[model samples]
Target: MKTPSAFYKPLAIGAPEPFREIPVSLERMIHFVPPHIEKMRAKVPDLIEKVDVVLGNLEDAIPADAKSDARNGFIQMARDNDFGSTGLWTRVNCLNSPWFLDDIVEIVGAVGEKLDVVMLPKVEGPWDIHYLDQLLAQLEAKDGLSKPILIHAILETAEGVKNVEQIAAASPRMHGMSLGPADLAASRGMKTTRVGGGHPDYAVLSDADDGGARAAYQQDLWHYTVGKMVDACLSYGIKPFYGPFGDFSDPAACESQFRNAFLMGCLGAWSLHPTQIGIAKKVFSPDAGEVEFARKILEAMPDGTGAVMIDGKMQDDATWKQAKVIFDLAKLVASKDADMAVIYGF
Candidate 1:
């Protein structure tokens, strides 16, 4: 079958380049409460300072009757305060819902100036992104906005997982794709009861003494999806992020999950609870020791010349490139946290 005009673009080859000049670390999703606006407002001052991105969630957890108030609260918050370099984002109602059009109209018309990104949930293919892209462009043009508002897709459906590459390449406004474990589990009819993460039922055990062992249980429910999503984003020159670590109480498990993504080249992970914010920041940012070592590699290499040995490992042009990634991330973290420079010895 012939590819649609929207999906006919050549496949993106090789590793993806970072999409944005600055790093984005979305603040843990905020649940809206009409009566708690004052409380939420009080928390914003501190939250914005610590997080690279603050997102006001308009779907899922918010009460149906309170959507308007929550939308208004975000507008008021954006108007009343200056977030400095921190990016302000929002998760709009899904396209299939009655509230989505209003969500887009109100958010765009009201605070389009301040918003940096619009997170679209349960995106199935490039068509969904294309519709949103055109609407956003029209809105921005009408509002006299200079910068185009970017879009982030939530990969949470069977078709979405299959067509992730096309969706990532759908528009220039596409920023990144996040692994939404909960909805994806439901859509795929996964057997796990947990949102996303490891399951006890998915494990392995050894047979009796001297007997041969066999492959046993299932592994990470989202690993295959995450790996594919990450590859898609990398191929298309966009960022890949781990959506949410829903277990709020287990900080250790959260760290492990975030670390897995970090090692796999994810830019960042979502923080649903305030406690997870520090863990995400700590795991995602390059460690102080690694940062210092990366600086040494650059100093030694100087002009990207010949290879050398560092910590019993071969250090060459390829190693230098790898080190630079760490150095750049450290620099970004330092820019956000003045104290980070001192802490990381940058």
Candidate 2:
């Protein structure tokens, strides 16, 4: 019989993640005041059904005095309520903060079994992760917990971004990384006031037609960071997630942003508002036409053989691999929704 270490060895080295094996799918962290625990609890049922993960925001949004209350409230809520399969996660205070040790102590001691992942912010280097990993292991050992709680780092600082690959590979508990664009912008000294999503000041110019004049416009300031972060996460065999789409009212723009990340190999994007949830699900889930085409391609290439023509493009091993991406996502999403399964013919 293979030992647990040997059993897990194959999965440690950039192995293709099992399809639909999403550990935790979360929307943005929901901020609430101490007095709003009842109100937050009222909202939980609706949120759990709509989202795959719901994280209690304990770090930034909570007031200093209320941090204690929020942490206590989250623990109580975790004990009292059942989030079912919708993974429960929390954004703990940074390790440098005074609240860091207490936050971990309380969460791990009280409700460690209930928590899925602890989102650590401003992770500058591997040492940050190593600290958390050791602490978490000690906590797990003390609590007699069977499963280890995962750690997720926010790539928000320049140092963090610079050492993202090392950070991702820091520990077995490091499950994924998210791009925290707001803090990242501030850390990088980007001249932007908004939290995240779009920036009008970052754009490109289209050339003038008859050498009359040139026009410039804004583009995504996050493109470079997103691409770099995605590459790092991919290299380390972890999931990459777009942090937040702050434009809650503009679903179209949110969808466009989420779609960009989806196309670039990100697993998911953050949804701050309830309205943005559908947009993320729609963008991340494969479209019907693409799913049909991929299905057709697989049927046509039963042997997975040489290049064949389809839609004026050569279909071969490479193309089939691309088609599998769509097919797999379609199947994954279809498992949860019968309507999607019917539409995709899975």
lDDT for model 1, on a 0 to 1 scale? 0.77
Kindly list the per-residue Cα lDDT of model 1 for residues 112-162, writing each as its tens digit: 878888999999999998888768767766666656677889998999999
TM-score of every prediction relative to native: 0.87, 0.87
Candidate 2 TM-score, true structure as reference: 0.87
lDDT accuracy of residue 69 in candidate 2 = 80
Question: In model 1, where do residues sit more than 4 Å from their true spots?
Answer: 1-36, 206-208, 211-218
Error of 1 at 209 (Å): 3.1
Model 1 / residue 60 / CA error / Å: 1.0
In every candidate, how many clashes are there?
2, 5
